[model samples]
Structure formats: C-alpha cells, structure tokens
Target: MEIYSSLGIQAGISIFSHIFFIGITFYALQAFRLDQLFKKGRTIQIQLIYILLSIAIGSSVSNFILDISNWSKQLPYIFT
Candidate 1:
C-alpha cells in the first residue's frame, strides 16, 4: 500500500508536468496563429501532426528530466 501510494504520487506529478508543457505549447501555437496560415484541409492534418510530435518529444524530454532529478535524490545514498 505504501509503495503504491508513493508510485501514484510520482506518476501523478509526472503526468501533470507533461500536461502543463503540452498545454503551454498548444497555447503558444495558437497565439502565433500557425494553424491559420495553412490551407484548410492541410491545416487539420498539420495540427494533428504537430500535436502528436509534441507529445512524443515532450514525454521523452520530461522523462529525462524526471530521471535526472530523481538521480540527484539517490546520489547521497550511493556515496554512503
């Protein structure tokens, strides 16, 4: 139960952080009106691709950052 609780907290934090970044990216894209510049049919396609690529890249990046931060947390124990 304790382990599950701990894991849940970590997972929740990771998910929220990822969502925050994804939301911000979409917000910025909207602000720049990037989708409006494309042809009508292609606009939807481009937006889909953009969103998928962003999630793929963003997840990898956020995982890397989380790993690094957790690595620091474990550093002291390794030396001991």
Candidate 2:
C-alpha cells in the first residue's frame, strides 16, 4: 500500500512537470519566425510542428530534471 501511494505521487509529479515544461517550450517557440523554413500558407502544418517540437524538448528537459532529482535522493546510499 505504501509503495502504491508513492508511485501514484511520483506519477502525478511527472505528469505535472511535463505539462508545465511543454507550455514553457511553446511560449519560447513563439519568438522564432518559422515561416521562412516552411511553405507559405501552411498554417496548420506549422502549428502541428510547433506542438511536436514543444513536446520533444519539454519531455527531454522534464526527464533530465526528474532523473537529477531521483539521483540526488539516492546519493546518500553511496556512502553506506
């Protein structure tokens, strides 16, 4: 029961972290003028690309943060 509770909490944290970072990535992406790199008038396609890119970058960053956190929590075991 305790393990299941811990797992649920971790899952919730992971989901929240991914969503938060993805939003940040999307906002940051707005500063780029991607029109020069794609066909003109392909607004829908460009938006889709932005979504995919944001997920890619955001998930990577979130994973890195989570891994670092998990590692830090385990550091004390190295001396034992």
Candidate 3:
C-alpha cells in the first residue's frame, strides 16, 4: 500500500536523523572533554544535562524537518 510505504519511509528517516543528531552532539561534547570541567560527583549531573539537552535539540531539529516536509500542520508542542 502506498500509505504504508510512505509511513515506513518517514519512520526510517526520523530514526536515522535522530541517531545522527545525537551522535554528532555527543561527539562534540566528548571532544570538548566536558567531564574534565566538572568535579567527580558533578560529572554525572553534567553528563545527564548534556544528554538531555542533546535530545531536546535533536527533537527540535527533527520537528523542524517534519514541518518543512509538510508532514504535519502543527508546530512542535513541547518545550515552548
């Protein structure tokens, strides 16, 4: 079915894009050695913050892509 095929394509693209975004974000953070800037116990907190921020950024980017593709009418609803 055309509908099912299109859905599958979109899903695949979304997953791949998210992985790429998160991977690049982590790579950049690691390259900066952000952990070294924090104390031992604080490293965990910083890592958590970095990861969440990366996800938030990735989600926003993906939402923007979806909007540009005209896949959905509404803007991203969260964190507004």
Candidate 4:
C-alpha cells in the first residue's frame, strides 16, 4: 500500500524532472550554431539532431539530479 504510493510518487517526479530538464536543454541548445555544422538543406536532420541532443543531455542531467537526491536521502545509513 504505502510502497505502491511511494513508487507512484517517484515515477511522477521522474517524469516531471525529465520533462523540465528536456525543456531547459532545448532552450539552452538554441544558442548553438549546429545548423552551420551540418550540410545545407538538411533542415529535417538538423531538427532531429536538436531533439535527440535535448533528450540526451536532459536525461543525463535529470538522472544526475535524481541520483544526488537519492544519495542524500540515504546518507543517514552511513552511520548507526
């Protein structure tokens, strides 16, 4: 009962974190000149790259934050 509720909460937090970070990542990525790096007329490919990069970077950041949060919560176990 309680465990299931906790799991649901955790899942919700994970989803929110991923989405929030992905949006932030996408916004930050706007500063990059990635379009210049690719060949001209690859608009679709460039768009895909942007989406993939956003997910990659965002998910990585989200995981790192979650790991830190979990670790902090476990710190009490380090002692009696």
Candidate 5:
C-alpha cells in the first residue's frame, strides 16, 4: 500500500515537472527569433534537433529528481 502511494506521488510530480518544463521551453522558443533561423533548411533541422534533445533531457532530469525524492521520502533515514 505504501509503495503504491509513493509510486503515485512520484508519477504525479514527474508529470507536473514535465509539463512545466515544456511550457517554459515553448515560451522561451517563441520569445526568440527561431522562425528566422528556421528559414534555412539546415538551420531548421538543427534547431528541431536541439529542441527535441533539450526536451528529452529536461524530462529525464525531472523523472530522475522525482524518483530520488520519492525514494528519499520512502526511506527518509537513508536520504538524511
């Protein structure tokens, strides 16, 4: 029962973090003159790859932190 609860909490936190990271990324990209760079085919491809990689990294980091937090909460003594 406790394990299930911990898993649920960790999932929720990871989801929230992913959404937040995506939102920030979207806004940052929009604020920049990315469209101008995208006018060139090569530049556009590079930019797309960069954005995808950034999002992937962000999600991975968020999931890792959420898992660590969940583990710490489940075993507070070890984390402390």
Candidate 6:
C-alpha cells in the first residue's frame, strides 16, 4: 500500500514536470524568433517535426526510466 502511494505521487510529479518542460520549450522558441527565420511552409514543417521528435524522445526516455525503476524494485523480492 505504501509503495503504491509513492508510485502514484511520483507519477503525478513526472506528469507535471513534463508539462512544465513543454511549456518552457514553446515559450523559448517564440521568444527567440525561430519562426521568422523560416519561410511559411518550411516553418510549419519544421515545427511539426520538432513537436513530433520531442514527444517521441520524451515518451521513450520516461518510459525506459520508469520500467528500470520498477524492475529494480521487484528484484529484491525475486532474489529472496
């Protein structure tokens, strides 16, 4: 029960952090005038690629770490 509660709290924190990171990324992009450097069509394409890559990288990294942590937590019981 205690472990479950800890996991829930960690998950919530992870979600909040990801959201905050994405917000900061967009804010920084706009502040830097990155959009102005590209032609209209290229800008849209670049933005789309940037967003897709961010989601893919973030999801994989987060899931991999979470899975490793979960495995480590189970290892003690399995070994015993």
Instruction: Give one digit per residue, the lDDT tens place, for model 5 in 1-80.
Output: 99999789867877899878766665565656655656566776867855885687677767777678768778968756
Candidate 2 regions exceeding 4 Å error are none
Model 5: per-residue Cα lDDT at residue 47? 70
Better of 1 and 4 by lDDT: 4
Q: What lDDT tens digits, residue by residue, belong to model 3 across residues 1-80?
A: 99999899979988988888877776666666667768887967988978987788777777777667763444554436
Candidate 6 regions with alpha-carbon error over 4 angstroms? 1-4, 16-40
Off by over 4 Å in 3: 30-40, 71-80
Tens digits of per-residue lDDT for model 1, 30-80: 556556668777966887867886687677667778899899999999878
Whole-model Cα lDDT of every candidate shown, in order: 0.78, 0.96, 0.76, 0.98, 0.71, 0.68
Give all TM-scores, in the order shown.
0.72, 0.97, 0.65, 0.97, 0.56, 0.58
Look at candidate 6 and tell me the lDDT of residue 21. 59
Backbone clash numbers for all candidates listed: 0, 0, 0, 0, 0, 0
**Between candidates 2 and 5, the TM-score winner:** 2
Extract clashing residue pairs from model 6: none
Better of 3 and 4 by TM-score: 4
**Candidate 3 minimal-lDDT segment of 10 residues:** 70-79
TM-score of 4: 0.97
Question: What is the Cα-based TM-score of model 5?
Answer: 0.56
lDDT of 4 at 12: 100
Q: Give the TM-score of candidate 3.
A: 0.65
The deviation in Å at residue 32 for candidate 4 is: 0.5
Error of 4 at 43 (Å): 0.4
Candidate 3 local distance difference test against the native: 0.76
